[model samples]
Target chain A: MLHVTTGAASGPGREPILSLRSAVFGYADRAVVADVTLDVRQGEVVALLGPNGSGKSTLVKGLLGLNSHLGGEVELFGTPMRQFRDFTRLGYVPQRHTLSASVRATVTEIVAIGRLPHQSWWGRPGRTDQRLIDRALDLVGLEDRAREDVSTLSGGQQRRVLIARALAAEPDVLIMDEPTAGVDAASQQVLAEVLARLAAQGTTMLIVTHELEALRDIVSRIVLVGEGHLRFDGTPADFVLAQRRQQDLILAHEHHHHDDDSDVSQAPGVLSTPHGPLEQPAQKRGVES
Target chain B: MNTLTTLTTLGGLPELLDYDFMRRALLAALLVGIAAPMVGVFLVQRRLSLIGDGMGHVALAGVAVGVFTDTAPVLTALVAAVLAAVLIELIRARGRTSGDVALAVMFYGGIALGVVIISKSTSSTPANLTAYLFGAITTTSNGDLWVFAVLAVVVVATTWLLRPRFFAVANDEEYARATGMHVTALNLVLAILTAVTVVVSMRIVGLLLISALMIVPNAAAQLLAGSFRTAIRYAVAIGVISSVGGVTGSFYAETPSGGTIVIVAIGIFLLASIGTSVRARVVSRRHQRAEHHPHEHGLGCGHPAVAHGDHVDYLHDGHRHAPHAGHYDEHDPRVHAQTADESETAAETTAETRSS
Candidate 1:
């Protein structure tokens, strides 16, 4: 479970695991997340924190090629993202089970699927593949329920299975989309502990989450996004300070801003102040969106 | 009437193998039996169950084109079905309409066009057209068996080889693509396979009844199956049993083979549903008993984590625990409606079934 595997080696001249320069992601002809640039060094746990629909998930999907890339260059493991073909080097955990409609695979079968890209079209898993799958289940502490249908698992446990499936690939960088959304507290803590263990073992991670409850202690850096813009890229402590500053700015400019209660209360992080110091947190408002 | 009685008296199991026509019908049934349901299980899982019906109508149009041109019906059906499959995929990828809506439009349009073409064609007789639409299993030729054999081999080999990829794509399309799976190509391949399967299976069950052969057995199997692998196996078993039984039953009853097979499959589905619901009720009762006596473990309970209550210690960091703790039971109605199979399996075995 705590194997010292090679992570994004970040010393002196080591290249970043993922680099996105002015990346623009969207659907059809519109850009949802525009001109975002960031670099993820090896073994560093980065968290993308934002209110709903702030493009944090879209940015991650753009890096993984799941979203439409309107413009910009993305590099993975020092290779161009488009040209990079070694899929086993990277792993991704999607938001939730709602998207997987027809899948009724057993826990073991779902975990075993993590080994698909590593094997040939018709070849069964080798001994090493089996061992990795087993280790992944053990890592998630789900080895006892390997044969149960994935639908049978609780919400939090299902999230763990997804993480286990990603870990089964033994990837260098694990990118997760809202890994703890709707998860119970106990399961979230277990997930936090598991991820912390992975980070300690030199695993690179990029997690997209709106809530910063269980992950507060584990994250090395935080990236704040709002209204399709990269608002702040700094440490967790700095992120808290920036929030306080934004709150103060909204209070000072209350009469001039003339925004609604929710909007004034939940303005975007510091970087988005260019938009008249009143970036409408439309998504966070309970009634507006 | 005497001759009919004679045939019925002689129509035992061995009598099916005696006639060349019956032998050919049985061979075609066996091939269609395994291929259709195997493909259908994936379709059902993907929520594309009606795609089979859509492809069947497209195949009927191909048959009409063949009748008009005096060409091979099966070959023309293959072409039309493949084109229609590609068209459906195109409409689906456009994302303007829901998949079900797109498929419905195509389904009705193809059948309507086929009917117009058949009515306009001079060479097509009413008898022949009726046979094509409803199926004439007694007229199945050796050449038809060869076509079925080739289709069966292609469908089985491709599905088996790409099993993992199919599962991944069906399970989560975005995650599969993120994992570097060529999802577009795989989707096209799956559509093509479905088109071919639908076209070939049409001969045994008729274009009108083809989707039943594809959907009903798998739906029943999903209800009864313990896992994905077992679902496939169970679907195949149900398919084979129902088809062979239907063919045999048809000969004795002097009924249409296609209709008989579909009806028998439905019967099996009803039986499976009844059995599953009964089991669900028993499991739910057992769970209620376990809930009352918290310390006493239920008989045959398999959820080890719930049993040990290990997760109760999980809120160590002052994280708010779920409001519904200590209520995780096999028969919990909320959990039951989500998946009844979990409760059924949990009520029957030790936890070791999965652990080992």
Candidate 2:
């Protein structure tokens, strides 16, 4: 058994950056994710993992107020979600497909958009804003391509540009939805390095991903969801151990089924290796996931 | 023929400027040229290129209302267009009706109502509606010119001041919302700006063809500009040239101002398209020709060597050059995927012969 703490036990008096209590998230009262209790403290990197149709994405959207809050309490930076207005403190990196392909904006122009939250309606970018934008482009290693049109870039480079846009805001907590999805392997490695560097800087991040391979080392905790409920919440090592045990149980049950049935080949096929039933649904929504 | 002879025999531009109506027409055209594309770039970015046409139809209804109530046509048109702009934005924001469908309904209903109302008005004539449908810039009064000036200033100043915010919403509304921007408000502001642009341009470019002045120059500018800022600059320049040139051409040819303006804008667009294609071909041909370099690039050639797929390329000057069988082959990463590999040997032979 693992001790599932509401928030990370890094220090005694540290407050949770994001807290949800029995949160029910959905669209128009049709709940997709229900009875979810989670808390993220300062400087903790948490990965929200779930299969397709498990409502992980809906939950993240709920936290951002994109989805309907069916019931329960959600808080950000110790304030209630309804009363919380300091949105600049939170940076969101949506999926790369969210960017419209028709826009003819330069890399610098896109990155400068992240500074809008800090700027007044009629104000231009000051020296500090320019420095931050430059630093963000530098962080993504895209300073050289700052003047090029974003549509001319490859898919992975465009993802990096999105990340640079989010980082330019200097948010206290960064929330990314599948930052490595649909990216090539080399770009995935680069994205992982960027996240690792951000983690080293003590930036709190809640990354929603189904696969943990790219962000395995950077993720401090793992929260697994299945069928719209929190199935497991623990350290990464404990989660791995739990996954292994579940795999062993499936394999042992398949062995018994093999003996009982004349169709032995079908028994092994029932138990998919490595991921088993928990990770199978991820491939169901291939276009989106 | 007579106007053409006068244009040739006299100093045409200076002589034409001597008339009061000509001065008003030129000023109105200049303002429309400057303001239309300034608002049009964002409309094009949002893919609402036809929204200008819809708004133009609505402004025609406003003109009918002015004729029916015996009021200034420009004022009533501005009022009607602004209301319709807000209504369309609200319907779009509610998400119940799709945007293009709403715009279509507005377009047909507006023109139908405009024609019906104008036909019933006692002061209306078919010629008055014709003048609005196709512009009669040479008939613009000083009062109409003053109204155009005010509306043009409002459109230009608002689009310039709120360009970044407008771009953010137009590029990606969800992303702008995530950044804590007031997207709904910005969208309404954009819609109102579009309405103002439509009204400002209706007298010079005509309500029927105002969208052309708003969109064609932008389309032409995008072919050559590498950035959005540069595109806006180029689009405004094209808009100014097309409108002024069209007005001058109409004076010489005895044509309607709106048709002449749209044709001039289309001419510029065709030129830009052909120029872009020719420039691309020229760049590729240049890249195909390899310069003669006596210094061989290798492991210790003092130049940085980058590992390409299965081969090494040496960075020289600004581009990379890979050593082939006997000569250096220039490797442009930008067009690497498009250029065929079989032509390398033939180009190398050409380079060798030229060097010899």
Q: Tell me the deviation in Å of residue A132 in model 1.
A: 1.4
* Candidate 2 per-residue lDDT over residues B294-351, each given as its tens digit: 5545454577876655456666776667644334567775454344454342222222
Q: What does candidate 1's lDDT look like per residue over A180-282, in tens digits?
A: 8886676677777678777777778899987676788777677777889876776666667767877776666675766644445454444444453323321
Model 1, residue pairs in steric clash: A8-A42, A102-B45
Candidate 2 DockQ vs. native: 0.29
TM-score of 1: 0.83
Query: Which candidate's DockQ is highest?
Result: 1
* DockQ computed for model 1 against the true two-chain complex using alpha carbons: 0.38
- How many angstroms is residue A56 displaced in model 2 relative to the true structure, after the best TM-score fit? 1.8
Report the C-alpha lDDT of model 2 over A1-289, residue by residue, as the tens digit. Answer: 1122223334546777888989999998799998888877787788988777778888887887777889889999999998888887888888765366555788889889999889887898899999999999877766656777887666767888888988999988888888989876766776787788778777888899865988888887887776787766767766677567665666686677866433233333322233344443221111211
lDDT of 2 at B76: 94
| True-structure RMSD, every candidate | 8.1, 8.2
lDDT of 2 at B295: 51
Candidate 2 local lDDT, residue B19: 82
Q: Over 4 Å off in model 2, which ranges?
A: A1-9, A251-289, B1-10, B96-99, B288-356
C-alpha DockQ of every model? 0.38, 0.29
